[model samples]
Target: MGTYRYRVQTSGFGLFLGIAAEATRLTNPPTMNVPVSNRVWLDASEVNNAFHGNRLALNEREVAWLRVGLDKVSGDIERIETSPYILISVRALEIFEVDYAEEALAPAIAGWATREFTLTPRLCNVSRDSDTGQFTFDWNE
Candidate 1:
């Protein structure tokens, strides 16, 4: 199996992100709404492959369980295959330095959003951090 990468999006300002991949899809039937001029709420769907050229963040064991698009994930480890796994959070402006943090759980370029997906064949931080602001991601287990 081949693990793919993706980011979660939300309507922080106006229209959020949508996934439109070949096999990826929304979880269920969606409802239409016009909150203010044009608005929606809690709308979750795997629209298209917006991150087709993105990178993977997984290990050999995990990569063995990866597929192209959305596949169910069953574990949570920080780094794999020398690459780091990230656990993205609520804030949109935060970023994990490539070579600093052990793994980076960063939000997509679209900005603030909430999503659930895993990236395999992780990316390694190929830098040497010598500054104070630089932080490293670590896994206790």
Candidate 2:
């Protein structure tokens, strides 16, 4: 089995904070794992409920990290505008996976982002070189 990684980008820190709080409450006891870097790895089963029916295969192992950052934009007025966004990265381990991130996970996140935060989320496919361990991103698909 191989591991597939994908990323989703969306702008909505305030709304996401509420959503995360609710998710944490709904998860009850909390099945998530948090590292020193403050990255929370969501539980696959709970993710389905939190994301409103984005089904993750139980046979495969799935992990996700949510991070908040700012996007800097320079406008014609010579002012820098900072927008907050959340970056979600998902990793799935399976054999013969078929664009699970593009077809399922991303859509789920996008749906929630749009409905809750009125924000659009962008999905990107990530690939890693076996020998060099370098990562590449494909934003087109």
Candidate 3:
């Protein structure tokens, strides 16, 4: 199916990086607490049309991270062409990046005072010693 893109802009803090992923539902229901102070959920068709019916320009790493979001919505990989997606907007200082080591299962994004979600893993990093800190996300892992 299509995917969801999250972009938030705050005063004095231009805009955080936008994240998107292929929309997939989970087979098992997992507990998720994504607060929506001001949020919007879009359908897969809408996402497709916006990107010329092609996959979004999300990088492999971003896509991998987004899978965490998808898993948060559901544990099993089904197809949900309906509601129950995630979107949020907070101050610029709210966004945080997490470095992962071994044993880190699903992907997740957590902010101060925000609810948490369990991200399911579908991608793995092979390396991270590059100057750009670019690591290859292996979907086969």
Best by TM-score: 2
Per-candidate local distance difference test = 0.23, 0.29, 0.30
lDDT of 3: 0.30
Q: Whose TM-score is higher: candidate 1's or candidate 2's? A: 2
Lowest lDDT sum, 10 consecutive residues, model 1, at 33-42
Which parts of model 2 are misplaced by more than 4 Å? 1-31, 34-41, 46-57, 61-103, 123-141
| Residues 1-141 of candidate 1: C-alpha lDDT, one tens digit per residue | 112233322232111222221211223322441111111112122122223533333343322212211112212222121222222111111222222121222212111221233334333222224565442322111
Between which residue pairs do clashes occur in model 3?
26-74, 26-76, 27-76, 28-76, 106-119
User: How displaced is residue 128 in candidate 2, in Å?
Assistant: 20
Writing each residue's lDDT as its tens digit, candidate 3 over 30-84 gives 2342321112221222222232344333334443453343334442222322334
Put the candidates in TM-score order, highest first.
2, 3, 1
**What is the C-alpha lDDT profile of model 2 across 9-128, one tens digit per residue?**
333110111122111212222334332122222333333323344544443322222221101001110121122212222233222232233223322333333333333444545455
Q: What would the TM-score be for candidate 3 when compared with the true structure?
A: 0.25
**Candidate 1 has what TM-score?**
0.17
Better of 2 and 3 by TM-score: 2
What TM-score goes with each of the models?
0.17, 0.26, 0.25
Ranking by lDDT: 3, 2, 1
For candidate 2, give the lDDT of residue 88. Answer: 27
